[model samples]
Target: MDTLQFLIDGFAVALAPQNLMFALFGAFIGTLIGALPGLGPANGVAILIPLAFTLGLPADTAMILLTAVYAGAMYGGRISSILLNIPGDEPAMMTCLDGYPMAQKGKAAEALALSAVASFMGGLIGTIGLILLAPVLAKFALTFGPAEYFALFMLAFATLGGITGKNPMKTVVAATLGIMISTVGIDNTGVQRYTFGILKLYEGVDFILAIVGLFAISELLLFIEERAGAGRKLIQVGKLLLRPRDILHVLPTTLRGGSLGFIAGVLPGAGASLGSFISYTLEKQYLGKKGHFGEGDPRGVAAPEAGNNGASSGALVPMLTLGVPGSGTTAVLLAMLISLNITPGPLMFTQNADIVWGVIAALLIGNLLLLVLNIPLVGFFVKLLSVPPMFLLPMVTMIAFVGIYSISHSTFDLYFMIGFGVAGYLLRKLEMPLVPIILGLLLGPEMEKNLGHALVISDGDWSVLWGTPLAASLWLVAGLGLILPYIVGPILRRRMRAAITEDAVSD
Candidate 1:
C-alpha cells in the first residue's frame, strides 16, 4: 500500500545517522519530563522549543526529534501515575484511577507492564490512523472557507466551558480576552488596531510569548505556592513483572480503547482526558457487571492508557492535515511548524513528505523504545517521580524566555513573554482552559485572510458564508460545538459529582 511505501521512504530519511541521534536525545528528555508531575507533553515541547531552534537543524530532523519526544512522553506519563498515584498530566489521570489502586495491592509491576503494552498498542493504532487519515482528511480540510473557519474559531472558543470544570463563565471570559489579545495586532486589511500608540505593538503579540507565559511562567508562580509543602513519598520499588495472561487480558481493552480514542481525538477541542473518559465508559459497557472497573481491574488500567495514547496520535492528524490543532500540545507543534516555514495542509502532503512520514516513523520508534524501557527498568522510571516541581518549573520558565529571545534576539519579545506568562498564570489559577486561546490564535489569521478572499471572490457579498453546503455544514457543526457545552455541562457535572460521592462512600 501507499502507507508501506511512505514508511519505507521515511526509514531512509529517519535512519540517517544525524536523525537517529536526534530521536534518541528527544526520547531521553521527553521521558524525564513525562515522568514529572504537571509537566505533560505540551509543557515539555514548549520548554524545549529553544533547543529545537538554536541548533538550526533541518526541519525534518527537528520534527523527528520533537515527535519522538512527544511519543515517548505519552508512554512516560504512565510511570508516575501508576507508581506515585500522581498523574503527570490530564491524559494520565485515568491511569491513576486504576493504576494507583493496583500499586497499593503490591502489583505495581503488573500494572506497569499492562500500561506499557497498552501504550504500545494505542501508539501503533494512532500511528496507523495518522497515516491513513491525514491525506483524506486534508482533502476534506481543503473545503473550509473563511466563514467556516470563523465558525470553527467560535466553536473552539466555546470548548472552554466543556473542559474547564472549575468555572465555565470565567473560562469563556478568559477565552474572549485571548481573542481580544489576538485582535490587537492588525485587522484583516493589515492595518493595526489595538497598538495603543506604542511603536513596539505594531507587529502585534507573539503567540510564542503568550504560550510561554500561560504554560511556563504561570506554572512557576503556582509551584511557588506549594514549594515547602510538596507532598512526595519516595518508593523503593521492585522489578516489573509481566505474563502472557496479562497481555492477553489487556488486548481486547487496548483495541477498544485505541479505536474510541482515535475517533474522539478527531473532534475539535476534545482531547486525551475526554478520550480516556469515553474509553472507560465503553469498556464498562462491554464489561457489563462482570468487570470490577474502579476497584483495580487490570482492564481498567488498559482502557485509559490506550485511549489517551491513541488520542495523542489522533490529535496530530488535524494539525498536519488542516493546520488546526485539536489540543494544546498540537497547538504548540502547529506554531513550531509554521515558524519553520512549513504550511500544514493538502500541499504539505505533496511538498513535505519527508517531514510528515519521518515524524510518523519516529513515533513508531519512540513507542518501541517506551515499551522496552518502561517494563524492565521500572525502578529507573519510578525515580523520575522524585523530581521536585520547584526546581523543574524555574528551568522550564527560563527555557521559555530564553527560547523566545534566541529566536530573533528581541528584548520586546522577552517582555511580552513574561507579561503573557503573568496573564496566563492568572487564567490558570482561574481554571480557564488555555487551549481555546491557542486554538483561536492559530486559526484566527487564517479565518480573516480566507474571509477576505471569499468576499473578493463573491464581489464583496456577505452571502458567501452560507452559499455552499460544505461551508454551511461546518457552520452548523461549529454552532453546535459552541452550544453543546453550555447545555450539557451543568447536568453532566451534577451527575458526575453524585457518582464520585457514591464511589467514595462505597470505598
Candidate 2:
C-alpha cells in the first residue's frame, strides 16, 4: 500500500506539463540519435548533459528527460539493425541476426513493428520489477556500513571486466588510469596528491568533461577515421502492417527474454549486451531445429530486442538502490545524478522520494511514448540514416564545444576536454573498454572515502576490510567475479560469434 501511494504520487509529478513535454522531445531526439549507427545510448545521454544544465532543469525534470532518452535509444537501435544489416549499437548486435534477413525478404516494416512491440513489453516488465524490487534492495542496503560498501565497490570493479570487455587486464589498466586521474585533487586531509602546481588541477578532473570527451568527442574522431555513413544502400520498408499472428507467435519468447534480461540487469557489470546475447542463444537452443532462429524467424527478432531493453531498465535497480551502476549507460546516468548533487542509495528513497518515484513514473511514460513513436514515425527516423556523417560530425562537435563551454565558462576546460578526447581515441584504438574508465572515475573517490572510514573505525586493522560476514561474502564474490571471467568468457564469446557468422552466411 505504501508503495502504491508513492507510485501514485510519482505519477502526479511525472504528469506535470513541463515534464511531459521534455519526455516527448527527448524521446523524439533520442530515436534520431539511436537510429544512427555507432552512436548508442551512452553517447546520446552524454551529449545532452550540457543541454540539461544550460536549461537549468531541476533534478527531477532533468532525470526524466535523460531517462526518456535512454529508453528511446534502446528502442531505436533496432531500426538500423533490421534495415541496414548494421547494429545501431553493441547491444543491438543480436537483433541483426534475423532482423536484416527479414528486411532482405522485404519484411522490414514487420521487423521494425515487432521489435517496437517487444521493446515495449520488455521495458514494461523491467519497470514493474524495479518498482517491486528497488525498495526492498534499498532497505537491505540500509544495513551496510563503510566496510560493506568498500567490499561492494571491489565487487563492481572485479566483475566489470568480465562483462564489458574482451580483456580483463586491459580493463584493469583503464580502471587504474581513471582512478589515478581521480586522485589528482586535494585530499580530505588537505594534502594535494597530483595537482602538479596547477590551480585548476586542485579540483580534480571534472567528470563531465571526461565523459563528453571520452564518449562523444572520441566517437566523433572515430567516425571521421572510419568515414562512417559512406556509400551504403538502405533496404526498403515494404509495408507498415504487422500481422496479429506474428505478435502471438513471439509473445512467449518476449516474455521469457524480458524476465531473463531483468535478472541479468540486476547483477553488477552484466549489461544489455549480455542479456541480448544470452536471450537469443538460449531461445535458439530451446527451440532446436524447428525454430529457424537466424533465418528471418520473428522469434529471433523479438528475443534480443526484448532482452536488451529489459536489461536497460534492470540496470537502474542497483544504480538507484546501491549506488552501483549495472550497465554503461546507467553509469553515465549515475554521473548525471552525482552532478546534480543527488546521491543515489538507500537514503535516496526517503530523502528524495519525489525524484526517485517521478523518474520511475517518467520511465513508464517514456516507454509508452517510444512505442507510439517508433512504429509510426520510423520512416522519419530511417531517413536520418541518409544524412551523411560529414554533416552530423560537425554538428556533434559544435554541441560538445558549446555545451562544455556553457557549463564551466572556462577555456582551460575546453582544452582539457579535447585532451581527454584524444586520449579516449587512443584507448579505443587499443581496443580498451571505456566504461570501466568512467566507472573508475565515478566510484574511485567514494571507494577511497569508505576505505578510510573503515580503517579509522578499526584503528588501521586491515582485517576489518573483510571481518564481517557481509563484507567477507562480498570479497568472496569479488574473487569469483575475477576468476569466472577467465573460465566463462571464451566459451560465451565463441558461441555468440559463431552464431553471428552462421546466420550471416545463411542470409
Candidate 3:
C-alpha cells in the first residue's frame, strides 16, 4: 500500500469539524502562551493536557490538540524575543540576537512577519520529512545505544556551549551551575543529594519554574529598572508586509536552517533550542563580517525561526515511530499516549495508523493556520508593549505566578520561582547568557543516565565510549566542537579587523 493513501486517510480523520476545532483552539492558546515570557511549548502543552481529557476527546483527537499547541507555541515564541529583547522560550533565545535589534530600528512588523513566514516554511518541511522519513530515521535511531547516546549529548553540550555567550568560559560557568542544580534531587539510584530533609526538595528544582523565573520575572525587574528614570520609548509598529527582496534574501537561509533543524530534531535529546542555536552559529560563520548577524540582519531572524519550528515538528519522529521521546515536550506527549493505553513503537504504525497519520496531518494544517493567523495579527501583538510599565509589570508577574502555581500547585515552587528570578536578574547584570543554563539543565540528567547505562553494559570499561564507529565519530565531533571555537574565534576576529581596515582605506 502506498504511504500516500494512509496520509490521505489521516487527513480525513483530522479534517473532522470537532478535531479541527481542537487544533485551532490549541493553536490560538499556544500562541498566546508562547508570547508570554518564560511560558513555552512544553508549559503550554502540559497546561492543556488535563483539559484535553476534561473535554472528553478521544486519545488521537487530544494529541492533535496538544501537538498543535506545541507547534503553535514554537511559532509564537519569537514575538517577545524580537520585540522585547526577552526570549519567550528557550528556543526563541537565538531570535533575540537579531530580532530585538530589528524592533529597536522600527521594523517590528517586518521581523515578526518574516519570522512567521520562516516558521511556516520550516514547520512544513519538517512535517513533510516526518511523513516520509520517520520510519527510516526511527530504524537508524534504534542503533544508538547508551554509549552512542552519551557521545551525542557531549557533542550537544560542546557545540551549544561553544556557540553561545560572549565568552565560552562564562557559558561554561552557567552550564556548570545548571548541572549542579540538576543533581540536587534524588538520583536514579534513590539517594537524595541536596534535599536538606525537605520533602518537596526530593524532586529537585523544576525546569519550567526556572525558565519562568529566569526569563519572565527577571525580565520584569529589568524593565522596571529601565523605566526608573526616563520612560522607555516604544518602537512604532510598521507595515507587516515584506518586500520581494526581503523574502528572497531570507528564503535560502530559511531552507538551510529548516533542513538542519529537522536533522537535529530526529536525533534524541537534540531539541529546538539546540537546533536553532546551531543554525544561528552556522549562519553567523558563513556570513562572516558581512551579515552583521547580531545586528538586525534578516538572515539572523530567519535562521532560528525556521530552525526552532522545524526542530519542534521533527521531535515527534522518535516519539511516534520508536516510542522514544526526543525532548521535554515529546516526553510529555509520550506520557499522554501511555495514559490513553496507546503503545508507541514499530507495531504502532500498523496497529494505529490512523492516530499516527492523523497527527501528522493535523501538524501540517496547524502550521498553515499559524502562518495565516499570526501575520494579520502582528499589529495587535505589537500593541501589547504600549501599556504602561506599572500596569504591565504587575500583570506579567501575576501571569508568571499563576502559570507556575497552576502547574506545580505548591507555594514552595512559587518562592523558588521568585528566588530564581532574582538569580536570573543578577546573572543578566553580570552579562551571563541564560541559554546555556537551560541547556545544561535539560541535558545533564540525560547525559548521566546514558553514561550509567553504558557503564553497566560495558562492566565499567571507560573505553566503551569509543568502542563503536558511531560512538567514536561522535566523540571526535565533540572534541572538535570544544576546541574549534577557541581556534576559530581569534582567526575570525583577525579577518574581521582586516576587512574593517581595508574598508577604511578605501573610504
Candidate 4:
C-alpha cells in the first residue's frame, strides 16, 4: 500500500514537463556516447556528470538526466556492434559476434532494430523487477551490519573476475590499491594518516580526481591511440528498414535473457557482461540448428542486447535498495545520492518514497523515449561514425573542460583534467578494470561510515558483524565470489572443446 502511494508521487515528479524534457535529452546524448567505440556507459557518465552539475539542477533532476544518459548510451552501443563489426563496449562484443555477420548478409537495419526492441524488452522486465523487488529489497537492507557491509564490499571487489579481462590477479591488485588509496585522508580517530604533509594531502587523496584521471582522461588517451592507425570507412549503409517479423523473431531470446540478466544484475558482484555471455551461450544451446544462435542469428543478437540492458536496469536495484551499486554507473548515481545528502537503503523507502518512485518512473520513460528516437533516427546516428574521431574527441574534451571549469571557475581544472587523463591511460595499460576503482572512490567513504556506526552500536563487539541473517547470507556470497570463478573456468573450457568439435563436424 505504501509502495503504491510512493510510485504515484514518483510519477508526478518524473512526468513534470521540465524533467521529462531533460530525461529525453539525456537519453539521446547517451545513445550517441554508446554509439562511439570504447567510450562506454561509465565513461559517458563520468564526462557528463560535470555538465549536469554545471546546470545546477536539483539532485533528483540531475540524477534523472544522468541516469537517462547512462541508459541511452547502453542503447546506442548495439548500433555500431551490429552494423560496423565494432563493439561499443565489452558487453556489446557479444552482439557483434552475430550482429556484424548479419550486416554482412545485408540484414543490418533489421539487426539493429531487433537489438533496439530487445533492449526495450529487457528494460521493461527490469523495471518490473525494480518496481516489485526494490521496495522489498529496501526492507531487507535495514539488516546490514558492519560485517555485512565489509562482505558486500568484498563481493563488489571480487566482480573483477566476472567482468574483467584475463587477469584476475591484476584485478585483485588494482582493487586493493584502490582500497589502500581510501586510507589516505585520515583514520577513524580524526588524525590524518597518509597525508604526506603536502597541505593538499591533509584532506586525503581526492578520489574524484583519481576517477577523472583513470576513466575520463584515460579514455581520451586511448582515443588518440586508436586514431593513429585508423582508415576510411569499409561499409556503406543503403537503407533503414526492419520488418515486424524481425522483432517477433527475437522476442523469446529477449525474454529469457532479460530474466537471467535481471537476476545477475541484482547480485552484488555479477554484472551485464557475465549475463550477456551466459545468455548468448544458453540461447545457442537451446536454439540448436534452427535458431542461428551465433552466425548472425537475430535471436543471438536479441539475447545479448536484452541481457545487457536487463542487467543495466537490474544493476540499479541494489544501489537504490541496499545502497550497494551493482555496476560503475550505479556507483556514480549512489555517489550523487550521497552528495545530495539523501541516505539510501531500506529506510529510504519509508523516508523518501517520492524520490525513489520518481527515479523508477523516469527510468521507464527514458527507455521508451530511447526506442522512439532510435528507430527513426538510425541514419542520423550512424552518420556520427562519419565524423572523424579527431573532431569528435576534441569537441567532447572541450565540453568537458568548460563544464568542469564552470563548476569552480578554476583554470587549474584543465591541468587536473590532463593529469587524470594520463593516469586513466596508465591504468588501462595495466589491465585494471576502471569501474572498480571508480566504485572504490565513490563508495569508500560511505562504507567506512557504515562500518563506524555498526561498530559503535556493537560497543566494539566483533560478532556484531553477523547480527542478521541477511548479513550472514551476504558474507557467504562474498566467500563464493572468490571461489566461483575458478570453478566456472574449467567448465567453460570443457564446453568450448565440445563446441569446437561440433564446428569441425559441421564444416
Candidate 5:
C-alpha cells in the first residue's frame, strides 16, 4: 500500500471516539505535568502507563495514549521554561535560558506563542520524516550487529556531554554513578550483583521512581528554599498572536532547528535535550549578533522549541525501527510494548501496521490539538505561576508518591524514591547535571549486553568492535564528539561572551 493510503486508514483508527478521548486525556494530563516545575514527558509517560493498562486498554490504544502524552509533554515543557526561570525538563533547559529573558522583558505572550508555533512546525517536519524515512531506516538497521550498535551508543554518549552542567568532569562522574546503579540487577548470565538479600532488589531500582525523585522531588525542595521574599515580575499578556514580521524572522531558524532535531533524534541516545542544546548553541553563534539572542529574541524561543519537538518525534524512529530507544521516555514505551507482547523492530511495521500507522496519525492530530489548546488557553497556564509554592509542592509530592505506589504497590519503592530525591537535591547543589545520570542508568545494561555479545562473537578479540567500516565511522564520530567539546567549547564561550558584551554596550 502507498504511504498516503496507509495514513488515511491510520487516521480512521486514531479518530475512533474512544481513542480520541484517550488521546485528549493523555495530552491534557501531559501538559499539566510538563508545565509543572520538575516533571516532564518521561515522568508523565511513566506515571500513566500503569493506569492505562489498569483501565484495560488494548495494547494499541494504550500505546497511542502514551505517545500522545509524550508529544504533549514535549510541547508543554516550554510553558514553565518561558514563564519561569525553571526548566520543565532537561530539553527545556535551553528554552529557559532565552525564554525567561523574554518573559522578563514583558514578552511572555510572544515567547509562548512562538514556542507553540515552532513546536508544531518541528513536530510536523519530524512526522513527515517518520513517514518517509522509517521504512528505509528500519531496513538499514537490520544490518547492524552488536559491535555496530555499541559504536552507535558510544557516539550518543559522547554527544551528550554538550548538554552537561558546566563541569564536564562532574558530568562524567554522575554518569558513572548511574551506570553503577544500573548494575544492581541480576546479569544476563543469571548471577546476582547487588540485590543485598532484598527480594525486590533482584529487579533493580525502577527508573520512574528515580526520575520523579530526581526532577520532581528535588524541585520541590528547591522551591521551598527559594520561596522567600523574592518574587517574579508577572506581566499581563497583551497579545496572543504572532506578528507576520516576527514569523518571517523566525521561519528559517525554526526550519533549521527542526531539521537538526530530527537528525539527532534518529541517532540512538542523542535525544531531544541534546537536540535543543545543539540548536541553542548554534543559534547563539549565528544569530546572536543580529537577533540579540538570550535577551528575549523571538528566534531564541523558536529554536529550542522546534528542536525539542522535532527530536521527540525523531526518537521514535529508533524505537519503532531498531527496538532501541533513543531516550528515557522511549525506553519506558519500549517496556510497555514488551509487556503488551508486541515487540518493536523492523518486523513491527509489517506485522503491526495498524499500531504503527495509528501512532503516526495520532501524533499528527495531537500536535494540532496541542497547538489549539496551548494558544487560547495560555493565560490559564500562566495563572499557574500564582499558585503558592507550599501548596503546589505538597500536591506535587503527593502525586509522585501516588504514581510510584500505583506501579508496584510497594513501600520499598517509595523509600527508594525518597532516597533518590535526596541524592538528586545534593547533585543539584553540587552543580552536577542529572540527565547523564538518567541516561547512564537507562543505557548501561543494554550497552553491557551488546558488549558481551560482540566479545562472544569475536572470541574475545577487542578489535571486533572497530572492524567494520560502519563501526569504524561511528567510533571516529564518538571520539570527535568527546574531544572536540573541550577544544571548541572554550573558544565558543569566549566569542559568545564577547558578542553579548558588545551588544550590551551597544544597547
Candidate 6:
C-alpha cells in the first residue's frame, strides 16, 4: 500500500512539463547515439553528462534525463544490428545473428518492429522489478555494518573481472590503478599522500573530468582513428508494420528473456551483455533446432532484445539500493548521483525517495516513448549510419570542452581532461577494460572508509574482516566470484563465439 502511494508521488514528480521535455530529448539523442555502431549506452550517457550539468538540472530531473537516455540507447542498439550486419554495441551482437539475416530476407521491418516490442516488454518488466526489489534490498542493507560493507565492496571488485572483460589480470591492474588514483587527495588524518604540492591535487581527480575523458574523449580519439562510417550502406526498412501473429509468437520468449535478464541484472557483476547472451543461448537450446533458432528466427531477435533491455533496468537495482553498479553505464550513473551530492544505498531510499521514485517513473515513461518513436523513426535512425565521423566528432569534442569549462571555469581541468582522454585511448588500445577503473575510482574511497571503521571497532584485529557470519558469507561469495570465471567463462564464450561463427558462415 505504501509502495503504491510512493509510486503515485513519483509520477507526480516525473510528469512535470520540464522533466517530460528532457526525457523526450534524452530519448531522441540516446537512440541517435546508440544507432551509430560502437557508441552504446555508456558513451551515450557520458557524452551528455556535461549537458545536464550545464543546464543545472536538479538531482531528480538530471537523473530522469540520463535514465531516459540509457533506456533509449538499449532500444536503439537493435537498429544497426538489424539493418547493418554490424552491432551497435556488445549486447546487440546477439541481435545481429538473426536481425541481419532477416533484413536480407526482406523482413527488415518485421524484425525491427518485433524487436522494439520485445525491448519494450523487457524494459517494462525490469522497471516493475526495480520498483518492487529496490526498497526490499535497501531495507535489508540497513542491517549491514562496516565489516559487511567492506566485504560487499570486495565482492564487487572480485566479480567485476568476469563480467566486464575477458581477462581478470588486466582487470586487477586497472582496478589497482584506480585505487592508487583515489589515494591522491588528503587522508582523513589531514596528511596529503600524493598531492605533490599542486593545489587542485588536494581535491583529487574530479569524477566528472575522469568520466568525460575516459568515455567521451577517449571515444572521440578512437572514432578519429577508425575514420568511422567511411562507406556503410543501410538496408531498406520496408513498410514499418508488424503482423499480430508475429507479436503473439514471440510473447512467451520475450517474457522468459525479460525475466532472465532482470535476474541477471539483479546479480552483482552480471550485466546486460551476459543477460542477452544467456537468454538467447538458453532459448535456442530450449527450442532445439525446431524453432529455427539461428537463421533469421524472430525468436532470436526478440529474446536478446528483451534480455538486454531487461538487464538495463535490472542494473539500476544495485546502484540504488547497494551503491554498487551492476554494469558500466550504471557505473557512470552512480558517478552522476555522487557528483550531485546524493549518496546511494540504504539511506538513499529514505533521504532521496523523490529522486529514486521520480527516476523510476521516468523510466516507465521513457520506455513507452521509445516504443512509440522506434518504429516510425527507425528509417531516420538508419540514415544516421551514413553520417560522417568528422562532423560528429567535432561536435562531441566541443560539448566536452565547453561543458567542463562552464563547470569549473578552469583551464587546468580542460588540460587534465585531455590527458585522461589520451591515457584512456592508450588503455583501450592495450585491451585493458575501462569499467573496472571507473568502479575502482567510485568504490575505493567507500571501501577504505568501511575498512577503517571496521578496524577501529576491532582494535586493529585483521580477523575482524571475516569474523562475522554475514561478513564471512560475503567473503565466500567474493572467493567464488574470483574462481568461477575460470570454470564457467570459457564454456560460455566458446558457445557464443561458435554461434556467431556459424551465423557468419550461413550468411
What is the lDDT for 422 in model 3? 98
* lDDT agreement of model 2 with the native: 0.90
lDDT of 2 by residue, 421-494 (tens): 99999999999989889999999999999999999999999999999999999999999988887777778778
Q: Residue-wise lDDT of candidate 3 within 203-224, one digit each (tens)?
A: 8767666766776577678868
Model 3: ten consecutive residues of lowest lDDT: 498-507
Tens-place lDDT per residue, model 1, 3-55, is: 68988888888888899888888887787778877778887787777678777
In model 3, the clashing pairs are none
**Model 1 accuracy (lDDT, Cα):** 0.76
- Can you give the lDDT of residue 502 in candidate 2? 89
Model 5: CA > 4 A from native? 1-9, 37-59, 80-111, 163-166, 227-233, 239-253, 264-300, 323-355, 488-507
Considering TM-score, which of the candidate structures 2 and 4 is the better prediction for this target? 2
Residue 138 of candidate 1: its Cα lDDT? 74
RMSD of 1: 2.5
Q: Compute each candidate's TM-score over C-alphas.
A: 0.92, 0.98, 0.67, 0.91, 0.82, 0.98
lDDT of 5 by residue, 253-275 (tens): 99999989998787655678768
Ranking according to TM-score, highest score first: 6, 2, 1, 4, 5, 3
Look at candidate 6 and give me any clashing residue pairs: none
Count clashing pairs, candidate 2: 0
lDDT, candidate 6, 1-507, per-residue tens: 878888998999999999999999999999998888888999999988988988889998999999999999999999989998888898999999899889999999999999999999999999999999988999999999999999999999988866675688898999889888888889888989899899999987798899999999998899888866564777888888888898999999999999999998888888898889988998998999678866999999999999999999999999999998999999999999999999999999899999999999999999999999998988888887888887778888888888888888999999999999999999999998888888988899899999999999999998999999999999999999888876787777788899999988876
Task: List where candidate 6 sits over 4 angstroms from the true fold.
Answer: 229-231
Candidate 2 vs. true structure, TM-score: 0.98
Which 10-residue span in candidate 5 carries the lowest summed lDDT? 226-235
